[model samples]
Target: MSDSSTVLKYTPAEMMIVVAARALAGVRTVFVGVGLPNIACNVARYTVAPDLELIYESGVYGAQPARQPLSIGDPTLVTGAISVTSMADLFGLYLQGGLVETALLGGAQIDRYGNLNTTVIGNYDNPKVRLPGSGGACEIAINAQRVFIIMHLKKRAFVEQLDFLTTPGHFHGGTSAQELGIASKGPQLMITDKALFDFENAEREMQLISLYPGVTLDDVVVEIGWQVRVAETLSETAPPTTDEIALVRGRLSSGKQSGGTGEA
Candidate 1:
């Protein structure tokens, strides 16, 4: 296929990586959770940013792998990863000490205040549904110097109030999350499939910073359930290039060969 003809078809997963990678580029170290964060971090490491440091909640620090890890607790994460230490020290010493500068976590529900919920969907007493539950998300979000959350914004997920606040809302509408003792402060950026958003000050309300490639600002507003404030001057998030597509595909293929589905 001609290079010009190859319009990189970025999967939803790849789009997730594109947005998440851009978010992590300047960050030196990240306390990454599984799923999208893992893929995005690895993508950044392989493509644009090589100096990225990964500190898994599993206690592996500075671990860099050639391909996307199958899971957060995957043996591959520990096998070649360096500074493998006790899970206790990893959190107590490394995370608590603020050694981790950034964190990437997912959410079942996120409010305008940047608070996350990964516990139950319905009422606390008689919940309609129970999620996988928070592993190290609460701790990582609280302790990391900065936090990043990836959740597609939809009516079901974005609610006015969470039935249960799984992780502490670091910052409220006008409070500093760090001062509130919730650790990492509120989310620095919330990357959705439709658009990108960043919080304004301690208000903790997400402001539309940019739209994903091939997505319009209007589309973002229409898709989100709540009112979304857009930046006066927004920029289009650069889409994955052909080179990026090839690299990502090659890595994912290698992962399949090494016993991974590379599903996400």
Candidate 2:
């Protein structure tokens, strides 16, 4: 347990994970993706939501992975899972069935409305960098009750318009997500390295509500492509407690926790 006076050493990645983990506190079932989302959900299971059930897109439900999984096909996701069904069932039964409470997603680019682009960097016909097309992310974005996006914030990443729209967030703004048939309350929160945002306004735009202890408003504004919207009363997010850092390191070992600070 960490005392109030203690200052634990942690990386920005670890801090982001801790804050992202905290956001899933009361959720019962989560459709977790790979990478940082996986790590954050694992930490949440131990700390806040002890009964949290993690559903993987690879058809593993209620997964209790023995260790960190490298990808969706990692065998560890199946070893201790409640059930391993077909990918069709995982999507049709749990995800689209309206059973999942939260879904975590990330992409190469995100717009002001939270639409994600994981497809390509430039024109689809003649691409600059061809990205892996969306696998189950588009479905997760559409079906989950609440979607949480996790990615490091950078000017190039948080763009005014995506190079290509791979997954819909809020679309044009109010009622657009509903009009587009996205069932989820799309991207309720976006946890970045410098600040935290919540889509609580009518437009469903990313609104800065909290900043990391040492970061400033300009620090976030300068890194985002669109004009940043500020919450009326901005709050500062506290550094991770000793206990949170320990949990994050437990699952994210081997320098994974100490990796890059930015989206790139």
Candidate 3:
């Protein structure tokens, strides 16, 4: 068990990163998205999953970036990579070829079935807030053996329906993705600051599996737009260890370009 006092020293964002990294403890290969997912993968390499191979969309495979990469195309990712190939080969040979084990993604909006929306906040043509459209997320989500989504849990982001489906999750639940010939097993886990959710039920709806130490069931439920299901044996997420907190903080503070706005 981690010391309670030490765990309180870290911010929620730091905790989220630690929790997300822990999810990849045994994963051998990961298709890493920028921002928080990148940090999580980097942290995992230093801690639990040292042999983890990180693949970026910008053609780097088995990347062991010395510092945080600004984007998928950042030069740091190519520094110590096993193979630096073209974007086409990386996507076609690795992702679509079904060689990647897991993909880590983030979204502006997510529905009960884990469908993601990163295109726009409102109407597509007019729009309330224009977002960075999917770069390779659609393909990665569709082809990775399994996918993990990491994002902040908010009422607006966790909606009943997405404004645009940039990436397919379990479409309408059940075996929809399989039926539609989507190669990957859609959205296996969702890691948020408040809680960790899993698509363990038959219908593939997000189920509350565990809560962060200070967060309550009500806290998570109130933020979700839909009536979410809770696991029968819900557990508390393990608090970030002193070492985990230190590693995450050290990496973030190392002057590497973290793509997103300090969300991790």
Candidate 4:
């Protein structure tokens, strides 16, 4: 097929979703947040990976939405979803009870220790800015079989220690997280706009495995604003395939044409 005639090409954002979705290729259920993870899950369900199941923090499982949901409480999230359960039951029974295979999250501040701070930036009692308080993140992190973090990494957001322990990453370091009363498995992958990182043997530190195309290791280091470790051998991220790109563009175009869900 001619390059122009063939369909499906993913954009950088969609490519990021594709990379995130790749991890869900064989996952049976995913406990997800509402933003990028939501779109990524839908993309996975419709495209490359069909086995990926979505579970909302609101306790909706098997949520099969024709379009992306705006939030955990979006009607489509409840209506199109296969089953809706109580929030407590979803966490206590499904999550903490060991039913979820993966949980995806995003946070404002992530430390080298892998700890997340989504609560506040300044003081706890009287803070400078009171961000949305941590939701079921602590439970999700503690209960899920595995975890995935999708965020645009920057120095300020990636800190030395999160101001507040919104979600446990690693209590200390090197199996200390497990020893520190944390029950769930540590993060499996940390996907950023610049590169992808894998935790170093249960340690809170990340080792660079791959860098996105047109992104250099030095470029990543500069943007990180911290002393992040990169492996001696790093690979370049493969650009999105023509088919993947086309599919994403088609979805975007379709959304625009249909007066799509106006959720950013």
Candidate 5:
């Protein structure tokens, strides 16, 4: 039995974190990018996926950080890690070697095809806002067995086409990833604050699979830049249960809030 009378008082950012964490329920090993992805991985570890191994790009593997690390290079990640290897080994042996089961990533821009752009906001030559260029995200996006992208549902962020393709999704749509010889399956899900999406369609376009509580199709449509497709069996995403909320809040209570860079 679960507590049914628990009050639902949470922010959209918190909801995103809880939802993203839930997506990692049974994942064994996750190559975690910084920001929201990092928080989600730790939340999942404290709640549903206790044995979840976290691998950081800075070469920390199976990291059980006492507190949320500021970045991948933050020494706290290496505190209780299983093995602190070199960047070359981590990428060559684990990520590209196909040992990583999943990778959680965030992007500045995402298209209907799930292609991500974290390079720049505007023109590459004369950029509007230069973002943190893809640091291991390109490799993780193409090499991880499965990739989960987390971002907020905003009109600007969810564009029809990216200003730049920093990380490949279903490149130009279709079997292009396969044709390009990408060994790992890409862009499994795109978790957002308002809705949950999956690239289950034959075209590999992002399809709205579930909507968060109180959010409607119109709301999602208004936020996305393109004419987003809806799932045939569209469903409402389950609200966070009492236990799930507690675990997430507890894990994030160490003065580290959930919101991160560029909606991800």
Candidate 6:
């Protein structure tokens, strides 16, 4: 799947889920967020991480959903769960207690330091769009061992500064979470339709690590609000294989592109 023509066979949304699913190759437990993240975890369970334990916000731990769940509260997640606890116990014992290995999250906007905004799109007091505000995402970002975020590349979505900081990515800068005495390693990976990124730098900025098979440097740069940094040894992401595409499509009923930058 190295050829751009081959990658074009699948929509960018399918590519994102395939890549996101592959990212959990060795991950054991994942705090699965809604939508794309949920589908990705299920794909991982069938592919890369067969023993992957999915933890949902609605108190279902070690979930084995038969089909793609509509939301965190979807009944499918609870049917085969290892254990279902109270929301308070789930958050306090697993997330905040530092048992979660990784979390897959999504947001409307993300800045250089990886700060997220899922609140008001404009001014909080007077907003243009009132998005679904943070519901456990704030705690997930701060408490999960690390986070993997998924979003399509877009100018306003990848902003210079978030309208309202909902989750702590890297915070002020590198090791800032440690400076603030937070134990979670914060965001380790971010998957986009056009590229993959990591914060493995002195400043912990969202550094581009690889481009999708058909995407180019200019393609990624034009979508971000700030001067995006590319990895010194950048490479193309492996395009989705036939089996991987089948699995992704099987999990995502619509196979639609992820929501674009949340009205940004």
What are the lDDT figures for the candidates, one per model?
0.74, 0.85, 0.87, 0.73, 0.84, 0.83
Better of 1 and 5 by lDDT: 5
The 10-residue segment with the lowest total lDDT in model 2 = 255-264
Which digits, one per residue and each the tens of the lDDT, describe model 5 over residues 1-264?
255546477777778888888899988999986677787887787666868899999998888766667888888788668899999999999998898999888889999888899999999999999999998999998999988989988999999879999999989777888899987788999999898999998899999999988898899999989888988999987787776666556645463433321111
Report the C-alpha lDDT of model 6 over 115-166, residue by residue, as the tens digit.
Answer: 8899989999999999999999999988999889899888989999899998
- TM-score of model 1 (CA atoms): 0.87
Whose lDDT is greatest here? 3
Q: Model 1, stretches more than 4 Å misplaced?
A: 1-7, 256-264
lDDT of 3 by residue, 1-264 (tens): 243336547777887899999999988999996777887887787667878898999999988776777888788787668899999999999899999999999899999999999999989999999999998999999999999999999999999989999999999999998999998999999999899999999999999999998898899999999998999899998898887776677645374534332212
Q: Which run of 10 residues does model 1 get worst, by summed lDDT?
A: 255-264
Lowest summed-lDDT stretch of 10 residues in model 4? 255-264
Q: What is the TM-score of each candidate against the true structure?
A: 0.87, 0.93, 0.93, 0.87, 0.92, 0.91
Residues 78-121 of candidate 1 have per-residue lDDT tens digits of 64565999889999999999888888877888887778889998
Can you list the residue pairs that collide in candidate 6? none
lDDT of 3 at 241: 81
The TM-score of predicted model 2 comes to 0.93
Cand. 4 Cα-lDDT: 0.73
Per-residue alpha-carbon lDDT of candidate 4 for residues 1-264, written as tens digits (9 for 90 to 100):
124434353445666776786667777888998767876665565554666668888878877655556778877676456679999888878888888998888898887767788999888899877889788888898788888888886777877767788988766768887887777777878888778887766466767889887777787777664687877678987776665454455563243222222211
Residue pairs in collision within model 1: 142-183, 142-184, 170-177
Better of 1 and 3 by TM-score: 3
Comparison by TM-score, 3 against 4, better one: 3
Given candidate 2, what's the lDDT at residue 165?
Answer: 96
What clash count does candidate 3 reach? Answer: 0
